[model samples]
Target chain A: MPEPLLARSALRAHVAPEIAAPAPGVVLRERTDLTLASVAAFKGREAELADAVRSAYGIELPTTPTRVAAGEVAFVWAGPGKWLATATGPVDFSTLPAAVADQSDGRSVLSVSGERARETLATLIAIDLHPRAFTSGDAALTHAASISVHLWQTDDAPTYEIAVFRSYAATLWRWLVHAGQSRGIDAKL
Target chain B: MRIACPHCGLRGVDEFAYFGDASVTRPAADAAETAFADYVYLRDNPAGAHRELWSHALGCQSWLVVTRDTRSHAIETVEAARDVALARTSEAQS
Candidate 1:
């Protein structure tokens, strides 16, 4: 294999030196290796696009406003006639009238988990973080710390991924750390 | 205020960004000047239920047509704007 290129975290020097498990119930970590892409079906091509995605990725393209994941391949309902797809490795979509673009660099993801994770998020956002309402596999574009974030619950143990603009990574990290302090956060850098 | 996003369920008002008057549709360019002007600039400020467009900015980012009671701030119906627009376009073409 060819030598791998060096990739730097959006949080760079900020999260580098050490990965600390700061407090108690909350575990904070920055997930930088995932790949993300914006996928949109062109005008008059919705059905064909869905079929193509199903064939290409071995997963259905969600038409309804919901997030669905099959293993490491996940589709996030972004807007009308559009979805954002994320996967663990390289992402490619070969279909007519379908637009796919790399969004991995544009977005920075922060993962938070543990018992009080829901409570910690609730303190920052005005949305209802009730388990019954925002369940596992559910995703939404919402504001936290006054910044636009795509928040999703990956599993029932109250694990969440907050994806924000790479430019706002430091700010979001600070906000998360502060909010999670009360719940005792174990920050992994 | 809370708006029920059809796909995402009930969420706080802060997650949504509002656009006015989903009830309005632009007139054909060649139509009467006054009609075009009305469609572009005039909007109703109703005290009761109103139909308006709201984007779920913090989630899904989908445009929704929300039927809400202006006085009580209660949402009566919420739907994906794409469906509504597609229906209207097809109906007009048909």
Candidate 2:
């Protein structure tokens, strides 16, 4: 008989669900319930794959480095031939024509919200996070805290969802926590 | 240096992984030893505009061909490397 299995979040050992009002303007929280998957179009099958995704999920798999949402599922273009999809609950892509792989356990997600969130992100990412530049629903794969991470502007309050490999999550979280110290942080870990 | 990625806009150099000289062409498999050696070991250290392959490792993950002035670090143009290479192949065949 197979041994019993247990599942744990990437931040299980790093963060706990609690709010720390470190300063007056920022709130950091672990995005614990995200479900992620990497979807890539098979070679020479781009259009067909996209049609299948749209028909199945009711949203276009973005072609450029942008983000789009329909209901609970959010899609971010990962690159030319690929996209990453995220939802608050389990998302099954088995019916789509694209190659889909589970990334829910492969990444750690964090959300930094509040009025000062953009300013805080600027200290780590070089991209123009200004609302004029990276407005709501915008996403990009970028370097932050010296690690490759995906960042998305989820709301007008300038909330951001940062997704990084599980291995780099701890280091990135530490950097973010430190960066927010000056402005004070409302951490909901 | 900052590169204006076609898809993701201007981004820091740290987000990219550079591989020098996109202009380099691999010698044919049956080419002479000298030709293969040159392909493997030789590269031009151009003083002016140079084209190189840069993979946006952190964002978009698109491989781009960036043409920039080395002396001033001014980027001239950026395009998808796959598109450029495919165009080149078709151009050569034509």
Candidate 3:
């Protein structure tokens, strides 16, 4: 039999011991245990797709630039009629009435939390990230440091998740490190 | 400058890419060569309010038709390109 495949982090080469240590100001963690898929409803069939998704995942599909989470599954609006669906476990979208493309290995997700999370992100992204402006469950399909990124606030602890194309993961990590340099980053690879 | 994306709310202009006049429509395939050339190469430089095509490249990735005052740099309205096209189709049908 052939050798089993190995899963490796996109930031494996960039993970330095000093950066990985638990710092006090900001906590950054890479999320690799997610099954991601891009879902796009066919023209005039958005309602049908939403209904199918609701029945399958028990969560409403966000029609705007927002995120709706039910248990471990979350649907983030990427554009008009388009959404990025993520789950901790495998989600079968085969029967859904929409175009679905698996993105599990195509994207990288990083979670930023703690007191300086918002400030650090504010320096990189152009959107208004204030607590009142961007509360929990709010998501945006914006860019960070010129890299297209999808950002969402998961909780009031102010934990934010930023997802970027896998190829840009290292660049995003560098930007995060630079942004959090003075503030102290607790990066967990 | 900022564009209030219909679906994404207000966003910086840098997040969007200009695609020129939204008023331009494709001519029929069997139309005259002169008409095809005009459609492909001609654009009117208007000083007043104009409808332009812009794509939100980094945010939401929606094509928008923005009606803006060229002289004042003020945006009067923004609509999704899909909706605008659909409306045009319905108008033509009706």
Ranking by DockQ: 3, 2, 1
Which order, best to worst by lDDT? 3, 2, 1
Query: After aligning candidate 1 to the native by TM-score, how far in Å is the CA of A39 from where it should be?
Result: 1.3
Q: What is the TM-score of chain B alone in each candidate?
A: 0.92, 0.94, 0.97
Q: Which candidate achieves the best TM-score against the true structure? A: 3
**Colliding pairs, model 3:** none
Which pairs of residues collide in model 1?
A23-A185, A24-A184, A140-B59, A141-B58, A141-B59, A142-B58
TM-score of each: 0.84, 0.93, 0.95
Interface RMSD of 2: 1.4
The better candidate by TM-score, 1 or 2, is: 2
What TM-score results for chain B when candidate 3 is compared with the true chain B?
0.97
Which candidate tops lDDT? Answer: 3
- DockQ of all models, two decimals each: 0.50, 0.76, 0.91
Give stretches of model 1 more than 4 Å off: A1-6, A15-23, A64-66, A93-97
lDDT per residue, candidate 3, A88-180, as tens digits?
987776577999998888899999998889998999999999977898999999899999999999998789999899999988988898888
Expressed as tens digits, the lDDT of each residue in A1-189 for candidate 1 is: 899867667886675322335446888888876888888888888988888777766677766556788767888877667777888876564343588877888888889898999898888887777987778877777788789888888988789998888889888888888887767787765
- Model 3 misplacement above 4 A: A1-3, A17-23
* lDDT accuracy of residue A26 in candidate 2: 79
